[model samples]
Target: MLRGSGVTTLQYTALTVLERRGGISAAQLARDSFVTPQAMADMLRALEQRELISRSPNPASRRELLVHLTEEGRRLLAEYTDAHAAIEELMLSGLSRAERAHLRSSLDGAWRALRPPR
Candidate 1:
């Protein structure tokens, strides 16, 4: 459903994570996007080449770099706003507001439950 936008789902997922988290390490982006670090490294290269994202040395950690969405990246995400809303509407159309909230809570709980021990 997300193809043909010049952006793969995984790329979109990484962008979304960066959007929400502001700036984060590539490894954190990988975990949040359900991808391996190697895969995220490749994706970040593509995104950077496309000018959709930028990375800079982390001030708090000299050895780490934080990835961030660029203005173009924000524009790209905004362009899909309608489609994203429509998709969510279609998926939740059958449920009441309360039920939707419950579903979100359940999903969050499941996500937390499945995470490996830190």
Candidate 2:
């Protein structure tokens, strides 16, 4: 489904993380997106080639490169938002509203618990 939209799952995940966190270092993005540093570097290059993201040197840390989503990236992400919502709706169609809420809460909790401390 995502492939048809020209966005891979990893790309979508990275885009969403950037949307939520704003500009952050490539290393930080890698950690947040659950990808290795090398993988994130390659992905960032691909995103740059697509003009979906921009990277700049961090003033605070010369060694770090801050990554940010471009307007094009945000637009693509918005387009996918509706598709994701439709897919989620279909996946959760069998559950009641309350059950869905509980499931969401539990999943969120698990995610938080599993993430490494900042």
Quick one: best lDDT, which candidate? 1
What are the lDDT figures for the candidates, one per model? 0.92, 0.90
> Model 1 clash pairs?
none
Error of 2 at 2 (Å): 2.3
Cα error, candidate 1, residue 48 (Å): 0.7
Cα error of candidate 2 at position 18, Å: 0.9
Off by over 4 Å in 2: none
* Candidate 2 residue 59 C-alpha distance from true site, Å: 2.5
* Cα distance off (Å), candidate 2, residue 9: 1.1
What's the CA RMSD of model 1 in angstroms?
1.5
Q: Lowest-scoring 10 consecutive residues by lDDT in candidate 2? A: 1-10
TM-score of each predicted structure versus truth:
0.92, 0.89
Strongest candidate by TM-score: 1
